[model samples]
Target: MTSELIAALRARLGDERVSTAESVREQHSHGEGHHAPSMPAAVVFAQSTDDVAQTLALCNAHRVPLAAFGAGTSLEGHVNPPEGGISLDLSRMTELLSVNPQDMDCRVQAGITRQALNQILRDTGLFFPVDPGGEATIGGMCATRASGTAAVRYGTIRENVLGLTAVLADGRVMRTGGRVRKSATGYDLTHLLIGSEGTLGVITEIQLRLHPIPETIAAAVVQFETLSDAVATAIDILQFGVPIGRLELLDEVQMDASIRYSGLTGLRALPTLFLEFVGGPEAVREQIAVVEAIVSDRGGLGFDWHTDPDQRAALWRARHHAYWACLAYRPGYSAMTTDAIVPISVLAELVAGVKEDIAESGLTAPIVGHVGDGNFHTIILVPPTPEGLAQAWALDRKIVRRALALGGSCSGEHGIGLGKREFMADEHDPVALEVMRGFKKTMDPNGILNPGKML
Candidate 1:
């Protein structure tokens, strides 16, 4: 059946666009996660929306399972083809469809990456704010409902995406939402597809909201003798309505890893907060002043400041590389990373509990997060043994339970995908899961769209 389907794909998309080659299949098998690879029978690269529609039509007709692949930087198994069929590679569909500077919105093909879009908008004094570290495709970011450091101010992909062009499981192209900021329209299917992770359909184009690049941007790094002081300072700033552009926390382990990984000439590896403020010069200065006083009250050390673009960029560079830094912190060890978010009130407690769990489990895990929004992540280093893997999962569950107990969620930004699917029931109501399954069945009746994901 796969052979017949492959032949059909080649006939439609040309032989060069369809591949059953071993190397290509292997490349399309998995993402950046530690999940074991499940190679698809074929990889089909789509160059246009029409190409996607036609290929999806073929797959649906053949009842051949298909998984969408974008920038392929997903940390979970969002791109893995567990039930091998066609790995629909959309990386070639990199076209900027439209940009409306007046309306502060733009449309682009699913394959255009975050960096590419921002680069295109660089001269316009406007930028897309969703920065989920990595050269992640805008479509992939939309699919995952990704959020990052600046999310506290500008919002996540969910909030910024104004519309989507999605090809359903049956190859029907549907456009949802529009350029308007608010609409009292139908079922809001745009949001339904966002964070759906391609389970219901393949997103081919996205209409995204854009924000003006700030007139003045300032970054500061503050170290604390205790994690409590660093966290408290962050919490106070958020609670005080600072509208901070970015607030990131790095525990001692993560700070140490980042110091070595990103190079630091005059900084200590203590519990640290990397902060940013963006607005008019006066507004940024005021925000920084308020945060500075808060930090000083909490006994935070040297408020190393930098308004220079190069210095600010370097600071974020280190924060973004925390994952790789943690991996390097324990050479020859696999890292299992988890993201759990709690209410601001309970974030400190949750972090303390997570620290305790890491110690009790005897694992080396570095913690980093955009804690201004109460989401934190830990990269747990594990041995290359079955016992190590089991221990990592056990710790993950403990962290999830802690968050849930605090009236938070199992996953803050990372979607369920293949990693957090088991925790769906634990996080959501049974009725919610049933409704999600209904939506899935209604959309992809043949179950060929990203099977065995989410609900």
Candidate 2:
């Protein structure tokens, strides 16, 4: 049956486009997370919407599970197929279909990466602001409903995505929404697929709302004597309506790793806030003044603001490389990153408790977060031993349970691909989970689309 499936895919997509090669299968077997890799029976590169529809049709007919692959950067194991079948490679379908400058929106194939789209829009003074700190394809971002530091001011993928084109489980082509800003119409199906994690269907194209380049952008890095002080400052800034473009937090350990790895100097190895304010020069200055007062009241160190474009880029460049820096702290160890979010009022409590837990566990975990919105991550590095794995998983679950107890989510940006499936029941009501399963059954009755993920 496996051989028959491979032959059928090769016949339709051409031999070069479909492959059963061991190396190719291995490449599509996992994402960036720590989930165990499972090789697919075959990998098919879909270069167009028609190509995706045809592949889905064949998979549906054969009752073979199908998983979509983009840049393979999902940290929740969204692209991995625990049950072996066809891995639909969509990175080749990258095309900027149309750009409506007047409407501040654009259309593109799912395979286009966020950086690629922003680069294409540079000349037009518009950019796609969803930066997940990796070379993540837009389709994968939509699939997981990803966000980044910019999410605080701009918003996550859920808000930026205007519409999408997808291929349903049974091979029928589907399109939802349009350039119109909002619709009061029936069931918002576009949103249903945005964060579905590809269990319902394969997203082929996306129409994204864009933001204009800020007239004056300034970045600042400030340190705090204590983690509580740093988090309090972040909370206060937001409460006061600072309108900062980005607000990030890095614990002392992460700051040390980042400083050493990124070759940055003069930053004290302490709990810190990396902030960016956007607007006209005067407006940015006023926001900075307001933020400085809040930070000072919370015992934050003096702000070091960067106005030069090169300096500002250098600051964020070091931040975007944070995960790599944290991993470098312990060579030959795997990092199982955890994502947890809480209300701003409880973020300080959560971070403080998690830090003490990591120290008590004797783990080398560096923390970083988009603290403006009360979302944070911990890169827990552990050796490749049974005991090490056990310790890491336990620490991860501890943090997750604490977040849920504090009216938070097990995941903020990372979707429940395989890692957080167990916590779905804990994080959501049983009825919510059942309704989701019902939706899955309705869309892909055969359970041939990305099985063993989400539900």
Candidate 3:
């Protein structure tokens, strides 16, 4: 059955598009996350929506699962083909279809990464702001509903993706939403597929909303005596409507790792708050003043602000390289990153409790987060030994459980691939899960679309 499916895929997509080589299969196996790798039987480097539809059609006919592989940056095993069928690589379908600068929107194929799209739009004075750190494909970002530093101000991929073209499980092509900003339409299918991971369908093209470049932008780095102080100041700034473009938290451990990894810094490696305020020059200055007062009151130390673009970029550069930095902190160790988000009110408590828990476990898990939105990540590093792996997994579960208990989600941006599926029952009601199952069954009766994921 698999051989026939591969033959059909190659015939339709051309021999160059289909590969059964061990190296290619290994590359499509897993992403940056800690999930065990599962190599697909074959990989199809789809070059167009037609190619995707044809492959899906063949896979559906043969009852072979199809998993969409983008930049392979998903940390939740979303790109891995656990059931082992065909991995649809979408990197080649990167065509900028249309750009409507007046509408502040553009249409592009899903294979384009966020950084690449922004580069193409640089001349237009508009930018796509959903920066999930990694150079993730727009399609995968939509699949996981990804958000990053700028999400606090510009919103997430869910808000930026106005419309998209998707190929259903049975090879039917459908479009959801449009260039218009608002619509009181029935069932929000656009949003339905936003965070569906890959269990729903394959997103082919995307119409994205863009934001005008800020007139003036400035970044600041402030150190706090304690984690509570840093989080307190961040929460207070948000309450006062400072209009911060981004606000990130890095515990001492993460700060140290980032400093060592990125090099060139006068930072004190204490619990730090990385902030960016965006607006006109005067407004930004005013915002910084107010934030400074709040930080001072909250016992924040070394409040350093920089308006130089290079300096601001350098700060965020270090922040974006957090995963690698954390990994480098403990060489030769695998990391099980956790993405637990809580209400701003309870964020401090969550971090504090998790810190204590980590200390008790005697683990080296550096912490970093987009604290403006109460979302944080812990890179739990473990030796390759079985005992070490078990301990790391235990700590990950403890963090997720704590977040759930505090009225937060087990995952904020990373979708429920294989890593967080166990927490779905605790997070969602049985009725809600059943409804989700109904949708899955309705859309993919044969279970041939990214099986062994989400529901």
Against the hidden reference, what TM-scores do the models get? 0.98, 0.99, 0.99
Ranking by lDDT: 2, 3, 1
The candidate, 1 or 2, that scores higher on lDDT is 2
Tens-place lDDT digits, model 2, residues 1-455: 66777788888889999988999999999999888999999899999999999999988888889999989999888888988999999999889999989899999999999988988999998999989988999999999999999999999999999889999999999999988999898788899998899999999999999988999999999999999999989999999988999999999999999998998788988999999999999999999999988888888878778799988898899999999998888888988999999999999999999998898888899999899989999999987799999999999999999999999999999889998999888877999989999999999999998898987
C-alpha RMSD in Å of predicted model 2 compared with the true structure:
0.9
Better of 1 and 3 by lDDT: 3
* Count of steric clashes across candidates, in order: 0, 0, 0
Off by over 4 Å in 1: none
- Score each candidate by Cα lDDT: 0.90, 0.92, 0.91
Worst 10 residues of 2 by lDDT: 1-10
Superposed on all Cα atoms, model 3 deviates from the true structure by an RMSD in Å of 0.9
Give me the runs in candidate 3 sitting further than 4 Å from their true place.
none
- Which pairs of residues collide in model 3? none
